[model samples]
Target chain A: MKPIGLKDLFVIFLKAGLAFGGGLGILAVLEEEFVTKRQALTREEFLTDYALGRIVPSGTMSALAADFGARFGGFPGSVIALTAMVLPAFTLSVSLSAAYVYLAGTPVLALLPLTILPAALAFIVAAALRLGRDITIPSVEALLAAAAFIGSLVFRISPALLLVGGGIVSMVILAFTERAENPA
Target chain B: MNPLQVALTIMVLNILTFGNGPALVPLLEERFVTMEGILTVDQLLYAFAIARVMPGPANAYVASVGFFLNGLLGAALAMVAIQLPAYLMLPLLRLHERFSDVAGVKRFTRGLTATSVGLIFASTVSIGRNAITSLTAAIVFVLALVMAYLLKWNPLLSLALAALAGLALHAAAPSL
Candidate 1:
């Protein structure tokens, strides 16, 4: 495929950002635009970017947009793509924040928490299941997962520390396992 | 609570978690609600509600959190802080050959991701304790799970149904 212009990159990501339902929703939009509609990237290329986005420590959609931008237009393109994708939600969040602050005491808006919070919890449960689907039961990964749950919920440890520490320990164990198996 | 603190908190959270916007909920609640006392549980729920209804990443709600704490400047800083870490991914992606070649990298990601899943569940329990205050809400929670998970309804549709149920239930009893 030919190189995509920065303007086109911005427009594509801007459209993707307008998708609701968060990250999964945005990914569908991006696949449609980049792979099927514009043919800017092949299906396999889009999937690779999606996988790369998963491992990076950022929102998957935002990271994917940056990667696509860097591919098409370099660093500047990357910045522009990410900005365009994030702008819509940021604007809405600020606007909603203003509304919530100003109208919080009213009875009508008070219903939001009663209605929304429960659903949000349900959403979180589903998200957790999706994230944990690959882990086998009674395994080392399960043990680490259980430890994280207890550390965050019971012991009240800093989640940032838990993630970093867990990742380093997991890497070392994996390295040792690999060395032991190969005997190199 | 100050501009610098808000920026740093958001930037740190973004750099640690890998996934969609909702992935930030555990760390975000830990910082703002449990640790700092910046916002109450209900306030954060309002932000999450608005985020789910709005377009873009759910993490965009960090702007709402910032706005609640310090107004427009906080919101702007939050957005910038959240987006900045995506650039960090650019460098890692640029080194994709070496990055993917390392077996340890994949294992490390697996471990981090599993832990994140656990944290998310922990936050769900924490948030649920505060949010599920009534029978109506409990019912809606079950209905939403069924719709969004089993039936595979769009979250927007499920949330809309939830809002309607809340209004009807609140009106019928006015006591819940």
Candidate 2:
């Protein structure tokens, strides 16, 4: 493997941020770019790595930065990857904070609550639909998703509980189904 | 509270909130007004307004509050505290790949992803309930959703159109 340099870090981070908006989808984007596009790893390999990224603590982007760096250029590669991934958004946030201190009190600010909030809601809904369509849910998985949605919305359950419950339910179903298919 | 305690609280809050920068708003508002005695409700709200109007992550807005309370070091500490989780977690996550082949683990990730989508939907419902105060607002919200889902419009463009619609509605019916 080639030594991962600053330029590689910058390219990966910029691409990850632009494609996935620096969120949960970073692994998918990275997989498509490096593994699928470059043919460095197979689809199965990429999916397994992505799954590992999610199960671990911390954000998916952080996991991707570390793993990708390690894969490309060992420990130093990991540093480059992580730095590139975070620097753009972190710098932008700091700069924006400086400007906000000046303009926050203006009456023009009221316009935003009336506009951006609604759009943000719409974005969330759209994201849910898009993700649901991508994942091939079996009947049991579908039930878990529906249950989690209702649990959060109607019961006003903590998101953490809903997530943990869904994970347990999926694990049970996956275990039973696998056993049925490969009984001794 | 002392600066060290404040810094620790901010760091823990940042990790718990999970989403990028916007997740810090409510937590900051509650802490700044109710606990820290650093800013009033009005000041916190104003900080929120300023944070949204300007670019960047919402966590940085807390630095503005820090600046108001204790000057340059306060501002720097607040920013560092909020961002430290991202910096620290990135390198440590490299070892995750060693368990990639585990079947049970993969199932858990799929479940978590689905649940995350559900949580996002719940949040959407709550935000929409608060934000769609008028028929015009509801219409703009629906239109933005349609543009995003059906027409594949860029989110920035949808946001721009919604803002224009809000401005027009406010002009047309000043009562709202």
Candidate 2: TM-score? 0.68
Residues A4-89, candidate 2: write the lDDT tens digits: 46577668666665443335445656776676666666787666555555443444456556666777777777767666655544
Each candidate's chain A: what TM-score? 0.81, 0.69
Query: TM-score for every candidate vs. truth?
Result: 0.90, 0.68
Clashes of 2: 0
Q: How well does model 2 score by local distance difference test?
A: 0.59
Q: Score the docking of each candidate (DockQ).
A: 0.68, 0.30
Name the docking class for model 2: acceptable
Residue A114 alpha-carbon offset, candidate 1, angstroms: 2.4
Q: Local distance difference test, per candidate?
A: 0.81, 0.59
> Which 10 residues in a row give candidate 1 chain B its minimum summed lDDT?
B14-23
What lDDT tens digits, residue by residue, belong to model 1 across residues B95-139?
Answer: 886656757778898778878888888888888898898888887
Off by over 4 Å in 2: A6-51, A70-77, A97-101, A134-138, A182-184, B1-100
Best by lDDT: 1
Runs with alpha carbons beyond 4 Å of true place in candidate 1: A1-3, A42-45, A176-184, B98-100
